[model samples]
Target: MRNHYLVIFILGLLLSGCVTVQLPGGKVTSAKDVEYKQPAGAFKEIASADADKSWISANTGNTISYFSECGGKSEPTLKDLENDAFAALNESKTLSSEEVNYNERAARQSRASGKLDGVPVELALIVFQKNGCNYTLTYGGLAKSFSAEAAAFEEFKNNFKAP
Candidate 1:
């Protein structure tokens, strides 16, 4: 009886060692190399912890910001990101939005008006998903001067590259 008990214990140990365990995959932090051209002219690169990249126009006080989100199990859709952003701005209104192609990927471009800190503001933004990441590039300024950097924003969006 003791021998039999010892054999059973050894078998249990062997079986446990042979068992394969599956662990969940690690979440992706970001792409290996995220590359994009800055907006043209007086837009100077600025440091921003919230954004992967950012630029400010000295001439107009307009700003361009780019940020990325790593798509884990629950990757967000373009509309989801857009709606969340618009919701954050007080009195936000979408002036125009359309589907477009950027870097050979489907993207959405939008023009919006809203208030920030009770000060009127206008925004132009492009949203796209690529390589397990969602990216947003936005240009914003005082409502009165938003148009000053509108063209540069277009150029910046056109030059974006996904890693």
Candidate 2:
């Protein structure tokens, strides 16, 4: 059973269509064929785990994480990932959360705002499937500065080109 699970995980990663990201002119690569919008403040690349990818902003303690949850007999929807994203926030730290444009957009984009561990945060999550791979772009940051950061993320999402 363990080996079976391991094989499934490996196959999932393989079928997920992972790709090496290139920083073109200091631009951050979201995914394969996905566009990147230069953010306002300086952000440093942080080490990522084997599965989920992550980054952090310099000025603010904002962090963005990219997760690809695809590759099975059945595929998951953006709304499903959006709910999972919200549930991901530590419930103990979450003060309040409400949907902010949590509707079906062009690419199933969703937004939510809340307080996490005494820090205000805004979450912008986009779920998309491209090139037989499902992807989710999650952006979390200080709510006080969320507007500006959200603008940057919005620009990036706008330029997203799926292969």
- Model 1 off-target regions past 4 Å? 1-28
**TM-score of every candidate:** 0.79, 0.60
What overall lDDT goes with each candidate model?
Answer: 0.67, 0.50
* Every model: Cα RMSD to truth: 20.7, 12.1
- Residue-wise C-alpha lDDT for candidate 1, range 1-163, written one tens digit per residue: 3433233222212211111122366364544587778788988886665567777777766777777666455656677666654654578899998888876778888878876656677777778888777777787777777887789988887777888
| Candidate of highest TM-score | 1
Q: Which pairs of residues have clashing backbones in candidate 2?
A: 120-143
Residue 49 CA displacement from its true place in model 2, Å? 1.3
lDDT string, candidate 2, 1-163, tens digits: 3433233233222222234343343332334544455444555555554335455566555555555533334445545555655653343233343333321233566666654543445666676666545676666665675565656566555654445
Against the true structure, whose lDDT is highest?
1
